[model samples]
Target: MNILAIESSCDDTSAAVLAPTGVLSNVIASQSIHIKFGGVVPELASRAHQTTISQTVAQALDESKLTLDAIDLVAVTQGPGLMGSLLVGLCFAKGLALANHIPLVGVNHMDAHIYANFIDESPSFPFICLTVSGGHTQLVHVKAPFEHEILGSTRDDAAGEAFDKIGKILGLSYPAGPVMDKLSKEGDAKFHKFPQALLKEGLDFSFSGLKTSALYYTQAKEDAWVQEHLNDICASVSEAITEVLIKKLKRAVQQTGVETIAIAGGVSANSMLRAKAKKMADTMSLNLHIPKLSYCTDNAAMIAITGKMKAELGEYADMNMKPFASL
Candidate 1:
């Protein structure tokens, strides 16, 4: 069966076609407008989705050599995103499904991130997945292909949010994780040691204190010195954040006894995090699974693949399902 999917949860507008074997085509059109504001504006993002969704879907179908009529199922991210953005994609999917007489499935954005690992390669069941993104930080125990129990999550700001917050202090643009990750390689990571807050037991995390620490440290520093050692500051902050994540992941893996470890979500695209995860996995004698850089971020192909998996498992949402802003 062929599935067509749409994703417009935040700043990116993406679409993809998925077959039983794998992704046939995936197209993404990211809005550069958010760069100027140093963050995503919900209204502007929703407007951009309205303008880009059709073209994105068309491109995916065209590139895959398939037509909308040939699509057996229509899937779209329904929640845990901006309400306006989610509405655009959900409405479009509903309309398309009604017009084409195909089934419409609502996919969770976080679930899609986990399924992204299954796109190119297949990881066995009962694995531990650490999903870190701009809006979420979670350690989920995957007992089966579609079965997951969230063992831990961030109580305050997520890892990506901390990166972007620190980026603002460093005078970087929005979506600053990538920029911070890049600059870290050029500077000394030990220049500044930020605090890592290990919240009340379990695998849950809290980065708000870390973010606040960076803010106050930057504020207390001399303007001239801050300018001179910007790279070092970025590197130090990134290193601290990565260390906290790795430390928590190790604890979770040991507690769960799941030897296979996987990382997903936007922040998983970080070079330092991936390298550290691989190193830790090897040292601990655990299997590691991470998606390619392109699939690390939000996209519709992941949603389509996840929907396909659900469909095969006889999990289908009724038409009464609605969008949610949070999980």
Candidate 2:
């Protein structure tokens, strides 16, 4: 089946075409307006999605050499994202499904992130995925295409959230996570020690304390001092976040006795995390799956493929499906 997928869950308006072989076309239009604000503005993001969604879908079909009639299924993200953004894509997809008499599927945003690993290679069943994104951080155990067991998740701010927040404190650009990741490679991770919150029991995470620690530490330093130590600061922050994540991932592996591990979501592109995950995989003698950089962030390719999986399972969403701000 040829599936058309739409993803407007946040500031990005994206569309993609998925076939049995793989994704044919994945188009994304990012809202640069958010960059100036140091964060996404929901109203602007929704409006931007409205403006770009149609053309984005058109482009996807065009690139794939397919038409609306070729789309057997229309899939869209239903929840766990900005409501207005989600609504734009949902309504648009619903319209297409109705007009074309196509099947409609609602995909969980976080679930799609985990399934992104399937785009390149299939991991064994009962695999573990560390999904680190701007809004969420989770350790998920995937037993099947749609079956998942969440082992650990963030208690407060997510790992990528911490990166952006810390980046803001350091006077970096909006969406500071990438910038921090880049600068982290240039400096010493051991230059400063940031607190890593380890949960006492099952796999759970807390980064709120780490963000606060960064705030207090930076405030104590003079502007000149901070500027000189920015690289080291970024490295230290990255280290703290990755350390907590790796430790929890190790625990999850040990508990589950699963030899397959993966990382997904936006922060999966982090150099430190990728390197550490590779090293961890080697040390633990586990198979590691990491998506290419393009698939790491929010995009429709993951949505399309995930939707195809749902469609194959005969899991369809009704026209009455509503958008959600969170799961």
Candidate 3:
């Protein structure tokens, strides 16, 4: 079956084609317009999606060596994102499905992130997934395909959000997570010790305190001092965030007794998180699954693969489907 998917959940406009074996093409057009704003602008994001969706879809098909007629299913992200951005992709998918007489499937953005790990390699059933993105930070227990139990989530700011916010304080560019991760690699993570938030029990997370701590850290120093220690500061921030995440992941593993684990979403692309996860996995004798960098961030391939899975189960959305802003 040929599945065509569109993902405009946030800033990037993406399209992908999925086949029985795997994804054939996954094209992404990132919006550089939000750089100056230091964050995503909803209106600008929706407009950008409108401008790029058609060409993006065409390029995806071209890259896949397939035509619109080959698309048997149209899948789109339906919720838990910017409403306007979600609407652009949802309406386009619905229209395409109507015109082509193809099946339409509405996928949850978070669910797609978890399923991303299945695109190339499959984890065992009942594995734990720590999904950390700009908008969300969650630990989910996947019992089976399409069946999940959210073990824990952020109480306030997500880990990625904290990263971007702290980066702004350091005068970094917008979408600062990647830049912060890169900068951390050149400095000492132990140079500055930041507080790690723990819930005292269970698996929930909280990064709001960390962001506040960073705010005070920057305010205490002059611009010159900060610039001089930028790399070390970034490394310290990365250490603080990843330390909490890894600690909770280890606790969850012990509590759930699930040796198979994975990490998903954009923040999983952080070098420190990846390295730390590998070390922890080895110590615990756990099987770890993490998607490639391409799959870690928001993309259409995850949506298409998820759509294919739902299609096999006869899960379809009709003309009445609507987009949502929260999970």
**Top candidate (lDDT):** 3
**What does candidate 2's lDDT look like per residue over 28-113, in tens digits?**
99999998889999999999999999999999999999999888889899978999999999999999999889999999999899
What are the lDDT scores of the predictions, listed in order?
A: 0.90, 0.92, 0.94
lDDT of 1 by residue, 144-203 (tens): 986889989999999999999889877888889999998888889899889978833678
Model 3 compared with the native: what TM-score? Answer: 0.98
Enumerate residue pairs that collide in model 3.
none
Model 2: lDDT of residue 134? 96
Best by TM-score: 3
RMSD vs true structure, all candidates: 1.4, 1.2, 0.9
User: What's the true lDDT of residue 122 in model 3?
Assistant: 76
